[model samples]
Target: MRRTAAALGATIMLSACAWSNAGLPASADETTEDARDSDVILNMFQWSWTSVAEECGSTIGPAGFGYVQVSPPQEEIQGTEWWTSYQPVSYQIEGKMGTREEFAEMVQKCDEAGVGVIADAVINHTTGADTGAGTGTAGSSYALDDFPGIYGPEHFNDCREDISDYTDRDNVQNCRLSSLQDLATGSEEVQDTLAAYMNDLLDMGVEGFRIDAAKHMPAEDLAAIKSKLSDPDVYWVQEVIGAAGEPIQPSEYTGTGDVHEFDYGRQLKSAFGGSIAGLDSIAEGKLDSEDAGVFVDNHDTERNGETLNYKDGDTYTLANDFMLAYDYGRPSVYTGYTFEDFDAGAPGSTATEVGDASCGAEEWTCTQRLPEIQGMVAFHNAVAGTEVTDWWDDGDNNIAFGRGEKGFAALNNTEGEVTNTYRSSLPAGTYCNMAAGTDCTETVTVAEDGSFEAVVPAKGAVAIDVEHME
Candidate 1:
């Protein structure tokens, strides 16, 4: 790590303390319990275990992220496409990402770096029936209804046809999704098998699991499966994409763990595309803050147009910055490969291997390393536990707000520069423009009244906090 443990701790604790001067910054010594933890999870989508481990020490740990969400590590159907990561054939800890030994090493290294590793658990289904007989990444031969000693036709749900009705909860839970054979999640044997697979990962230092296709299984079944875990208290974030008229909702599974708030990203898309000033009222459509896991974008939403992607350019960065700065659900920042087509794989991916992440602009989006994104990691921590105050906006694309007296930010999504006098809750000082880095040449001066005039660039932002100053 570039910074010592002391330095990282101090940087993260900057704004997570109690304030007295209305919005005055906390002292460096205020290392409260809240300061030690930040709900920042970097979704290293499609990144190899080696790449994720390397990044944990160098970037993720130093950036103040508490966890790294990786692709499914279990053995999957051999393929070059990105979605293949979701197709599980065995729980052997061998996928295109890495081998079992490499996976264990990544967990240890990331743990030493103070970053927890969360696996994407695909317990809802196995390989698609149409995929036919094929060998998995670990050389395990898999047929649609037969996975050697692991599973057979008896373990699958009786609903053999594709899911045709989402409103009917039985079909959605029992039928196959996209011809992928659904598991009999309710059976005692099936739940035991799933629990054993997850226990193996937990034994290897995996801190949590992202329940892939959670909506396809009943909430009771998921709760029962989790109860069988070695540590049922371990984090579990389920992927329940809540639709308005759909019978299943993300709220139904909160008893087991957190649910990804799809509405948060969808609302971000709507607000950022129109008037970002409306963000102050964004809670109207979202799940309860604590139960929700929020992200600017994810693997599915990026391809499906449900949220913004790297292709959206500067607007995408601004949205991510907003996600970190705002007090909402546990925030996860996503970084993934660059592709012209939806089905394309990461740079050098083959049937049994994927290349290391290069983090270049033209190839991998590497959102975690962007100045506007990484710098905000500190800003988010600095302003933790503070409420949004001193809100100001043009009722359009330009908006500015403060997190009590700890920090402040102004976002402008217009084409040209939007210069304005913004209100803040900070004390008088020359603070660093965190849209740049802490060692940045650009700076902002706050008067005694906590107001400053600055030019927020086109589709850009200007952010400052007590902890990040010139």
Candidate 2:
């Protein structure tokens, strides 16, 4: 789903699967409902179950993140490579992430903190590597196409070679991706097997899923699998990488749930990398803001340098601040361990047993814990359903906007400080600058006419919501 190239080929198969009542409703109702509770999600990339549990109880829950997207928990190939999680070996809820007991405990603790856990479900395929046969992390052994109790050669796609023609929908869906084994999703037996695994997670109290490589499976086939799930109301966000003129469009998968808006991230990178003024044109883009799950960057893009990340310093924080301020898609912030090699797994052991995550540790990059980003999460939740009103810009690097009367934000992306008097939507009063933190040295006083003058620091931002009013 990350890399791309191909040509058209003969179509291989199609399904007559009917729509499922178990899937989420095809309306903005879910979006509106979710915003009312917690609008922001945190993708805690590659964190161990123990680490996730501790953070959920101590930080993530109190910070008001609606959900945490954890790494794939299924048993997978034993290796230190990060992509090993994508190459699942069995449905057992045990892998480098943690054991089944630890995973259940994490889910329970997160739920207690009012945070839902979104498991990264890797059901599209099994181990595709020709690394011979071996036992997985959970002690499940397998040969090339022979996963003992879970699957056999019959459950895999007939097209047993690497995908050569992305332009061909058949080749893209049925053929192996990057030499990984492709599953026969159209098979009812496979659907039942996948549903059993997902339902097991649901039984463990998981609220939703981030379906990995969803575009590799036919829409109808996915629908068939979803129809068998026990939980009818769980949330979903599909990883469908659709670009202009691509054979697979994100919209095709919307029937199941919201699609990860890769285009939105690209646009944010372009705007933040150049001038803040370019953001004014973002509203006119092709993506429907309501049904999109937006983010500044994800685990994949951050490593590939296609999007801005924590390493970009204040510029990265500013971009996320802008995202939270704007009433676009449902925003998500990412946190992960630091790495030099793109494919390197989490720091510590040989990637067999993940180490405990600690903010003070040299390997962790907890971007979500940054004061500015944390403040913006509250700003996003506080201004839900409010319209983007009173937009103002300097025709260059500075821009300020208000979310009706609920909140206001001014960003100075320029190299030098910017002092500007802008119309505000907030009530007249003294307010602490949330972006600066609770012990902030800066304060803004709005007059009865809803106007305030602010001196925003270069590469820094100031955000104030009704909740932060003094």
User: What stretches of model 1 exceed 4 Å from their correct place?
Assistant: 1-36
Q: Write the per-residue lDDT of candidate 1 for residues 89-175, one digit (tens) a residue.
A: 777777789877888999889877878888999999999999899888877788979877677899999999999998999999999
- TM-score of candidate 2 versus the correct structure, residues matched by position: 0.92
Considering summed lDDT, which 10 consecutive residues are worst modelled in model 2? 3-12
**Which candidate leads in lDDT?**
1
Worst 10 residues of 1 by lDDT: 19-28
**lDDT at position 379, candidate 2:** 78
Residue 235 shift from truth in candidate 1, angstroms: 1.0
- Over the stretch 1-470, how does candidate 2's per-residue lDDT look in tens digits? 11110100010012322222222223322443233257678999889999999999898887777788999988788888888888887777777888889999998898788788889999899986577687777666777888876678899999988888778899999998888888999999888888877877877777778889999999998889888877545678888988666699888987877788888888888888888876766767645776788889999999888788878878988988898888887788999888889889887746466777789986899877788877777777788778788888888889988989988999998888888898987789987787775455678888999898888989988877787776
| Clashing residue pairs for model 1 | 15-382, 23-405
